[model samples]
Target: MDNQFPIPGPSVPGEAAPLPTPEEATPPPPSYQAPVSVKPPVVKPSPIKIILPLLAGILVVGLLVYGITKFIGSRLPSESVTTGQTITLTYYGLWEPSSVMKPVIDEFETQNPGIKISYQLQSPQDYQDRIKTALEGQNSPDVIRLHSTWLPLFAKNLFPAPANSVSATEVSTNFYPIVSKMLISGTQVYGVPITMDGLALFMNNSMFQQKSLLPPKTWEDVLSAAKTLKEVDPLTGKLTRAGIALGNTGNVDHWPDIVSLMLLQAGVKLTDIKGAEASATLSYYTDFVTKHRVWDDTLPPSTVAFANEKVAMIIAPLWRAPEIKSINPSLSWQTVAVPQLPDSDIVNWTSFWFEAVGKNSKHPQEAWKFVSFLASAKAQQILFDAATSDREFPQPPANKAVASLAQNNPVVSPFVTSFETAHTFYTASNTRDAKTALNSRLIKYLEDAVNAVSQNQDVVKALVTLNNGFAQVLSQYGLVAAPAAATTP
Candidate 1:
């Protein structure tokens, strides 16, 4: 049995052991076999296979998260970010103080949780120069308050309103007609005005009552009233009381506006400013001194004259109401719409400020959002109320809806009524512009022409010079997009 059950040899280090003989390898008998425990051999997986699956899962999860984040962020405000930082917009405002704009700013920030407004009231001195410099600079205000006449001067630097924020259609529909003309370019709107103001006739109630005259409805009516109400000292041949403030830029306040209104009413295209209508309009304006003998340079400014009861009537914006009141609180006065052309549709003038977004602003979208809010009907009402509480009265709202509500307000009604048919030109006065500004430069030519006419110069020659001057100024300012018009002198 021992010889038959041969033992196996030791295995070589590098080689497998030889197979055992049948006798040596014989299995134990089934009945007498002792229990044997068996364990399977342990196997290690390939590192590349494990790592590839894990990397693939991680990449899929990362892509899913990134896609979700992008989709969610696209719907939020353009100024908003996932980091949850509030955007601050720098606003350069004129006239309205920080205290006046604070409520509106706060309301806007409340509505748009992602934005806050930093308001600064800019001084009127050199405002045009400063704003132009700011717009050209890298660090520019996000929002700016600009005059409607300055549109041509600043349109290149202004950011057009995004259709999603404020569309041209919305601007035309919601605001006054002049708004569309001033703010809308093609399908884009560049700005929105909070107030609507133009020329209105202010009459001393005592003077009108004594003469039994109603508010002038036509130019004829105005001329007649001027003649009837004027009081001249026969002994000194000096004007003790003036009829109207219509002639001579030296003493007439807002002479440019009055002149522009007359020109527009006479169907003179200010851009061209030629033809018989232009001559007649200028003559009509100057005639109040030279021919009509109603107003002259002998008196104080038109506003002061009206306040002192030295002038029976004056054409001025409603903002002057406070000044006139401050000058003479006990004086009885009434406001009426500016006189219209006889047998013609109503045509009035407008000069007011609007809110614009800077083209170079880092937060243009946010800026436009705040401006759009300020232009809304709700915001207009709020602003009008705020102004009313803050001061004696506010200018008529540019929002047609809000203006309509003030139809019964005596202080605002005349301007509100005029706004419906109002138009604006670049010749607006009191803009507090630089000497080299478009308005100031253009107004110089206007002043020269008016002075010439007042001094009895040939109307046709004066107007020819005026037309050439207008061409030069409009072309220089890039206000006229057309080819330089040929001016005949």
Candidate 2:
């Protein structure tokens, strides 16, 4: 049976009556329920997508840093190193650049692409000191300019030419006989001469002609001229002019020149294959200035006398020729071989300038090659020409053949002739110390003797004292190997 109210359709067992009105209907509070179990969709990434972009960014940053660092480094100057392939050389000298030397150096460089050269110039007065300091400091130049007199000082430390560069026999044959001997000591040849110079009598020709005097040919003539020129003003009693400017205190390295020339003239061997001679030779030097007064204080210092024309003659080197011409172009002058004592044969002093190698040189082969080039006849001839024309020093070439090229020039003829008879000054094996002693003690003795003569001291006693002092110095250096044979002058 159907009830009229629709029997509360769909009524639950535990029913609560609900008003059907829309406004009155209230639903049970909403209840939360657990969600249904369903697996989430899986996603996979591609290797390229993950790694390529990251790697590209990293690479770009790395490249940028590298470029910046390289750019900064590029701004710095390059310092060269002579590794296994390259070579470097160092040279010292009185280098006056000329078109001649420039081409020679350029040619050498062009020939040896693997080599580079460094050059240094030193003044004549400081040459020895600079060399000694360099050697002791272990900072020596690969090649150095050496005066022949200073060779003995650097002998032991020198690097001889290698067998590959030149044989000893060839060296002797190639160079002048005297120069070859000079380069040798014991078993080793230590250096090669690049240039030569010698002492000569430089006379003011105009002055001689004015006085109606012939150029002095003998020591007596020189003495006579000195006396004639040694005039005192009647009122002032002061000297006006000195005939010959024999070397004095202010001249650079003048005493040795004076002593050596005199000794040679006197037939005194200052040194020999045996060693230094102590007595006869040095005593003669002492007597010449102190006792004879041939070279007296009456003459002014070299700089004053020569510059002022107060001296009519001077014993100077061929190198001085250019300077003289420059100083007084109007003053006519001529050079002659230095005069000899009446009883003695003429002998002049020889001096050489050379190139030497340093022990610590990075490129010894390159250094030797450069030196060889400099010593070559072609290079020497160029140097000779340049020295004559540009430098005014007219350095005589080391090569006799090259020197002969200058023979036609009248100004150079006398110097060339003088070179043939020149003798090297004696220098002890310990040359630096020996030269100092010579300039100081030996030179002072001569000076003192001159002063004594000026003060009217007995000439004989002064000479004896000088001789004794020289003997003591020789003994100190072991140079006086034996008792000197006594001789009466």
Q: What's the lDDT for residue 75 in model 1? A: 81
Clash count (model 2, backbone only): 0
**Candidates' lDDT values, in order?**
0.81, 0.59
lDDT of each residue in 119-149, candidate 2, tens digit only:
5556656557777778656566888876665
State every prediction's TM-score relative to the real structure.
Answer: 0.82, 0.68
What TM value does model 2 have? Answer: 0.68
Q: What is the alpha-carbon lDDT for the whole of candidate 1?
A: 0.81
Best by lDDT: 1
RMSD of each: 30.2, 38.2
Which pairs of residues collide in model 2? Answer: none
